[model samples]
Target: MTHGLHYTVNCSILLTDLPLLERPAAARSAGFDAVEFWWPFPEAVPSDAEVEGFVKAIEDAGVRLTGLNLAAGDMPAGDRGLVSWPGREKELRDNVDVVVEIGKRLGCRTFNALYGNRIDGVAPERQDEIAVANLAHAAHAVGTFGGQIVVEPVSGIEAYPLKTAADAVAVLDRVGADNVRLLADFYHLAVNGDDVPAVIAAHTGRVGHVQIADAPGRGAPGTGDLPLADWLGAIEAAGYAGLVGLEYKAAADPFAWLRG
Candidate 1:
């Protein structure tokens, strides 16, 4: 059975409910062999029994975990980010430990890290400095669990700080950790008015993850003008063999429509 691409999960796309025990089953039914998610444990993690069950379900389904999104605790109390968050650095570090533990349990090897918002009155250079320091700590913690940290660059309109792949690379360079890598999402590239293949080419060595959806509307790959097949080919040519995550919402059942 050929599952088109290396099927993986992005929690929000397949399972919105937290402490997801059934997600593994759902993913299996959908022909997925790997799963990923935002944060299953928000404020507090799921119980040991619950996690055991979830892990068992995944094992039963024969699916591996590709990555886990470590950017979930970044809201009011959590302060929502890894670096450039002045007062909440401690909380961020603590959260990283928790995320890393989850990854270890799931046998996952990658974590999607967000650098955080840009302060209204702060200079860009200062924000970069903060991101470098904060992400350095995060990468260290992730490494202890034998996991890799992927720095995702949000669009300037979506996030105040670190809004481009180039920006993310600069921060990663500053962090100077081999564990820190890059995460490229097509939507973010479209939002930021970027050329996907061009960015991929420029940063091939640092990229560890790739996500895709249609432009304008984040529907499945074929729904918009994303040129997904071509882009996938480009990334492949660039030497990325990691999962190309399909992180989008379908208007209907994802499998309902087919070319033949």
Candidate 2:
């Protein structure tokens, strides 16, 4: 049950009290050498200068950008993601290079795409088709950078179709893109009623990245009922050597939960 863990702070969710670009440095100050984030630009393709500034911030902070999310529609406003939404194909298409380019600069190889909420009046089949097409497109684009696309199953979010490893795998199958894989977030899987150990044991190879938050409150590890240390041990035991993204609501010091 012991393993070396490579932890990456999710800058988008953690260290929010500081400026967006400052979080990387803050994470470094706290002893982390790598970080990840959701899309930081409101425009999928922000000005080149803006991209430079963001990358510079990470470089200046001396933190490696390990993972990043593809543009999901205004996450602050709860758009979930537009990749599968009807009439939003253009938005998804526009972001393909934006994310991949950033990843290329940051040497990041993992990109997460959230499945948006089911839209009203949109036929399920059409939406699914669009999703598969978009996912396939992203997967191919990421593959150019030697990266992989990840689809995560969220918990307590009924609107999003992916809440189980099997569901994510099905999407991966539909896309038929070799680079697309499942994001086995223990917090989501446990809160959504899946056997965390069983899922990790079976799908270790397909889970390109891992994320964690305690169940019941989605708070920092040790704040809720999840046996996080054990779960992580299982993930490592299953042969996943990727960075584990620390994604949870932190009210105090972000590193408090991980310290002995």
Candidate 3:
């Protein structure tokens, strides 16, 4: 049922019914040995105590942190990322050290860098220029710790770009960094109208990580029409040997599919 791929629970999206600090242990109790997360703090840089508590939670749970997102902007306020935004370059840069340090402590080597939404005042070309430069900077910094960066194409946000595997891969090519790779999320790709199998077949070499959730509802696997099993098989057959993150919203028990 696992399709021969390793699985990592995404604590940021899944297991949300519990407090942030408790979810790592909760994931462990649910039989997961590895987990990933979006930025767990409200801002790009958090207090030292906040950082310590976040690190302690993961350490005490004894689960390996497999992936993390650099500080994207205010997600709840509708900001998608800071990498392409003009004025927040320093914030993004400052957050890199925090992310790298956390990764170094928790054995996480993969990081997700979200592409920011388009602003009315900024030219699209200018944003692209900034995204390339910023991504390169982050890549070089994380490379010091043997960490790699991943860029994802998200759905549901019209302003946010990078909606296809090609879009993300194009940016990676522009950055021209070996450590930068595409994050193939089945849910986002399918929701954005990209051919999932075609993407895997064509871009497996550039894929650094993979995430999954059902389409139409963005729920657990069986709740939607995506042929998740078939696509996962294709991903494995295509030779992507990495953890597949379970990033989905749960209608009830998120792990019910695991029991099935």
Candidate 4:
């Protein structure tokens, strides 16, 4: 039913067979014309030469870089993000400049800002205060490059605050910035017990970006129990004309899901 939907591969989680710079080319080889990524560099801000090399890789691969996340802090080390942490405001603000530069270079319009996990002994209200202020800062910063900011609700994480679609919407409303919107990743929503189609039907207009992986296991479409094709149909039936990001792990030939 989602026969005509357009998709972009998130190279950060896919194409493990190749190095980071080569994944864009791999995506193009696998029939995708565009790709997205998490913050690619190990540091929040990498050197200009390093970034230019990333740009050149995408250029040489001939694929459009459509979406990118602002640095979320050592993801592998479990520091979910830096933007909302109380004393790390400087780090979060520093991250904005490079993210804006990359978006400008790639002509990318969507930027995702992940909310950091709640720090122990930090009140939720205090963290919420930090998050709102930080997101507003980011929204305006990204807007300078004509880019939109999106916040996502990641599931199975007790520490991160935005666990529902409503939670994400509240952040958007609190920031009250026209350029900020929801990420609406179906896999996360489903993992958190959301009826994906229902949520899509209700808040279609606010969904600025979408990411997908199947449920039970974060694998490609046909490898899990989610009605991915059906939900995608419903998403399209609503008004989202943006690209759906393939953000799942490469569990045994992920591209086969595309063919199926």
Q: What is the C-alpha lDDT of each candidate?
A: 0.71, 0.88, 0.94, 0.88
Residues 1-260 of candidate 4: C-alpha lDDT, one tens digit per residue: 35567999999999987899999998999899999999999888899899999999999999999999988988877877876889888888888888888888888999999988989998988998999999999999989978999999998778888888988898888889988999999999999988788789888899899999987889888778999888888888786789999999876587986676
What is the C-alpha lDDT profile of model 3 across 49-74, one tens digit per residue? 99999999999999999999999888
Model 3 segments more than 4 A misplaced: none
Quote the positional error of residue 216 for candidate 3 in Å: 1.1
Where is the poorest 10-residue window by lDDT in model 4?
A: 251-260
Candidate 3, poorest ten consecutive residues by summed lDDT: 251-260
Better of 1 and 2 by TM-score: 2
The superposed Cα distance between candidate 2 and the true structure at residue 146, in angstroms, equals: 0.3
Error of 1 at 211 (Å): 0.7
Query: What lDDT is obtained when candidate 1 is compared to the true structure?
Result: 0.71
lDDT of 2 by residue, 113-196 (tens): 887888888888899999998998888899997999999998765688888899888998899887999888899999999888
Give lDDT tens digits, candidate 1, residues 10-75: 656745443476776677777777887766554534567755665686678677878877654545
Off by over 4 Å in 2: none
**Best-performing candidate as measured by TM-score:** 3
